[model samples]
Target: MNDALPREIHAVLIPVGSVRLLLPNAIVAEIAPLSGLEKVERAPAWLLGRMPWRDDTIPLVSFSLLTDANAQEDVRTARVAVLKTLADDDEMPHIGLLAHGLPRLITITPDLLVRTDGGERLARGTSAHVLVRSDQAIIPDLHWIEARIAQALPA
Candidate 1:
């Protein structure tokens, strides 16, 4: 006798290398063309560099490289996905992700997403492996990713 309608969530599917990341649309600030990046010295390979956005310079990271340390993908033609940081850090309010192309907006309902991990190990910086409709996407661990970015940024 339960007749409640399933809640729908607005989300975005961002292409990073060969993987597609599913994230809430609210967290995505902007998807801009990849521009010149100021290199960060002694930073990890996952940390691509600092990119200029609006009036502040934010760190740009390669999600593929962050998940798999050995992943190598050319970023010369990548796009920048500016994400609003969740942590309450005054110094770093946002971070950029190196996306392969423009992200696709999708509406997700409870029945539309299914957990596809199947007891398999999830990648680092990833919360879960899910199948949204016919497409498989990874839910990124944004908190963990933000912490990693904060630790790698120069003081």
Candidate 2:
């Protein structure tokens, strides 16, 4: 591993249904529960809508559908993992990810990470890894997830 990268990354591990995911701490701006989410009409099913964050309103992508899981019906309280994505001109911008519950922050070392294979048991754009007693996975790039969601939206 290059010295440029941190030997250990402070990651936020979140449990979504049965699987847990590790999110890079750098990109995470804040974790906030859903409040006044405005639904976007004709948007993709995975897209819950836009929510106010500070002075901006960013789109929210459901991690469930992003993993090709069945749409959850009873999500009264959602934890939004606010992330920054580079715009077309290389400007860092914010977006929110709608997850099921709270996110636990932990420091993860490279030696502790194990590659995983979800195979046909899962869908595309989903990744897995082994961390301690459980299998952890993460969507490495939120922009790609957002792009997938954007692509799926009707024109």
Candidate 3:
């Protein structure tokens, strides 16, 4: 047996628009149906709005719009991925992402993951473009996203 082989990482492939977001399963709190998004005035287009979840209302964002300004917000068959924020602040402990479809669970091994050249400029909210097996996905910058969300929220 190869004892030195890297352990496998259980992850999720979340469909945003044309691209997929590769994220660890731990950060994903829940996958809920898209509903009751209260639009916020003077907010950026990328900030979809706010959605009700449990006893709290969390900000929802369109990953596609964040990366590409021209990307349209497709609501048909849309779902909200409630993600646990990386930060320890209580004001914004969780944020939601508008997903085009249900996320698929994937097991990631070091050998199966490959770094790919996304382009001359990587999109906002994305840390790296990678290919997991045959699927091409982007690793999201959760900290950056959380900061942006925190700034956007009305103080």
Candidate 4:
């Protein structure tokens, strides 16, 4: 008789501004150095722009600008974490997040994740602000963010 292997959940902790964005590792396509993008006219500051990747173009969402309406963007030192859209739309399959630093891969388990007060009062797009081994981190709502991105796409 064969037994099924135990499943393990992995996530990446991406640094964006002063916060750490927690995202499931499976959703992340690749971590690339920040590059120039085509700006979306009339878009909010939170909507950074669109960056080209592979054979397709992916829009970059500014995590910093989203959290704080007052955004002072400093992209010169940032990186981009290309993510697979959870929206399941072929028109926009991928999106990028402006990450401040390199992402760190970590194993996610019950013992490591603990709910904290940081994210409780924040608005949507954040699943929760948790303490991973006592270090504060924000769990991003990929679906929610992706949905917003879809709406913000230039018509």
lDDT by residue for model 4 over 19-110, one digit each (tens)?
89888899999998777688998777788888888898889989878767776778988889999888778899899899887899988787
Error of 4 at 28 (Å): 0.6
| CA deviation > 4 Å runs, candidate 2 | 1-4, 86-92, 118-122, 132-135, 152-155
Candidate 1 residue-wise lDDT, 88-145, digit = tens: 8889999999999779999999999999998788878989999999999999999999
Each model's lDDT: 0.92, 0.68, 0.90, 0.83
lDDT of 3: 0.90
- In TM-score terms, candidate 1 sits at 0.94
Off by over 4 Å in 1: 1-6
Every model's TM-score? 0.94, 0.79, 0.92, 0.89
Give the distance in Å from residue 21's predicted Cα in candidate 4 to where it truly belongs.
Answer: 0.7
For model 4, name the residue pairs that clash.
Answer: none
Better of 1 and 3 by lDDT: 1
User: lDDT by residue for model 2 over 1-155, one digit each (tens)?
Assistant: 56587787887877654556677888789988788788888877777788888988777877766666675734576678888775552322677777677788877777777666534343555645455435556544455675775565445
- On TM-score, the candidate that comes out on top is 1
lDDT of 3 by residue, 1-155 (tens): 87785588889999988989999999999999988889988899999889899999999998888778799987878999999999898988889999987899999999899989646577778899999999999999999988888888789
Against the true structure, what is every candidate's RMSD? 2.9, 3.3, 2.9, 2.8
At residue 53, what lDDT does model 3 achieve? Answer: 96
Q: What is the lDDT of residue 86 in candidate 3?
A: 91
For the record, the alpha-carbon RMSD of candidate 2 to the native fold, in angstroms, is 3.3
RMSD of 4: 2.8
